[model samples]
Target: MTQLSLHSPVGELTISEEDGVIVSVDWGWSPFQEENELLLRAKKMLDDYFDGEEVEFDLPLKPHGTEFQKNVWKIMSEIPYGQILTYGEISDRLNSHARAVGLACGANPIPIIIPCHRVMGKNGKLTGFSGGEGISTKRYLLELEDTFNNLDDNLSLPF
Candidate 1:
């Protein structure tokens, strides 16, 4: 696996690649000193995203997960940049339960790239996030995407 770390506005992110495909994007820096074309591209895309450029990541990803989890993540990847989806909505699409969908989202190896942060709770409420700073990071990501426009009027942000 090749790992490259880059600092972003949110925090330091370490992207891991295996066989030229992104495997995971973890919070914080990794000491693994390696870089490849894919890693550099991923870093540039992430940089552009953080710069509010509305960049779409077009990299190959190979996240390891169960069949169900992969299905959920695939659905997540289709979520638009500035849109949000509820667990219930995803469950309805997959014919699964909300809790199961939430679990699948939590298990996502790649967070921002796979966009698990775009998933919220019912009524547009904030939910758990596995990333650093938890829901705060999730909120930051949502704000970065300007997804608050899609949030329910009843949903309030800490800003």
Candidate 2:
């Protein structure tokens, strides 16, 4: 595995790639000195995203997880760039309970790329985020998107 760490608006991010596909994005620095086309592309896409540019990552992803976790992550990838979804909503779509969906989300290997931060609790309440600064990072991401329904009401933004 080749790991490259880059700084982002939230914090330092370490992206790991193996066999030409991105494997995971951890929330810290890793000292593996290697870079490839795929890692470079992922870094560029993440940079564009943090710059408030709407970006759809067009790279290969190879997250390791169970079938159910993979299914949940796949559904998460379909979430719009600046849109938010609730665990209950995902559960309904997958015919599973909210807690189960939340578990899968928590187990996500790639956070921002897979967009587990877009998932919220009922009433758009903030939930757990297994990333840098936890829920704060999640809120920062949502705020950065600046897609809140009512811009006038700062608190109206979905978390």
Candidate 3:
């Protein structure tokens, strides 16, 4: 696995690529770093994304997870930037339980790129994020996307 680290507003992130497909993005720096075309491209995309530009990642991703997790990740990936979806919403679509969907979301190999932060609790309630600084990290990403402000019924951020 080849990994590269970049400093972002949220924190330092290490993106890993295997066989030219991105496999995971982890919090903190990776002690070992390697240079490759794919890693370089992923870094650039991350840079632009953190710069507040609306960028859609066009790189290949191969998140390692179960079929159910893969399906959950796929649905999360399709969530429009700055948009939100409740765990219950996704579970409804998958005919699975909300807790199961939340579990799959928590296991997502790639966080920001897969957009798992877009998933929330029912009624726009903020929930745990297995990446970065937990719920605070989720709050940061949602605020960065300005999603909290757009929530209907004036659903305030749960914090």
**Number of clashing residue pairs in every model?**
0, 0, 0
Could you tell me how far off, in angstroms, the CA of residue 118 lies in candidate 3 after the best superposition? 0.3
lDDT tens digits, residues 1-159, model 3?
999999998899999999989999999999999989999999998899888777788889999999999999999999998999999999999999999999999999899999999999988889999988899999988888888777896676656
Predictions in order: lDDT: 0.91, 0.86, 0.92
Ranking under lDDT, best-scoring first? 3, 1, 2
Judge candidate 3 against the unseen true structure and give its global Cα lDDT, from 0 to 1.
0.92
Off by over 4 Å in 2: 150-159
- My TM-score estimates for the predictions, one after another, are 0.94, 0.92, 0.96
lDDT per residue as tens, model 2, 1-159: 998889998999999999989999998898775888888889999999999998897779989999888989999999988788889999998898999999999999998999998888876778899888988898888878864552335334333
- Weakest lDDT window of 10 consecutive positions for candidate 2: 150-159
Give residue 55's lDDT in candidate 1 (0 to 100).
78
Instruction: For model 1, name the residue pairs that clash.
Output: none
Stretches off by above 4 angstroms in model 1 are 152-159
Ranking by TM-score: 3, 1, 2
Per-residue lDDT for 1-159 in model 1, tens only? 999999997789999999889999998999886978999999999999999989788889999999999999999999989999899999999999999999999999998999999998877878999988998999889998989976668876545
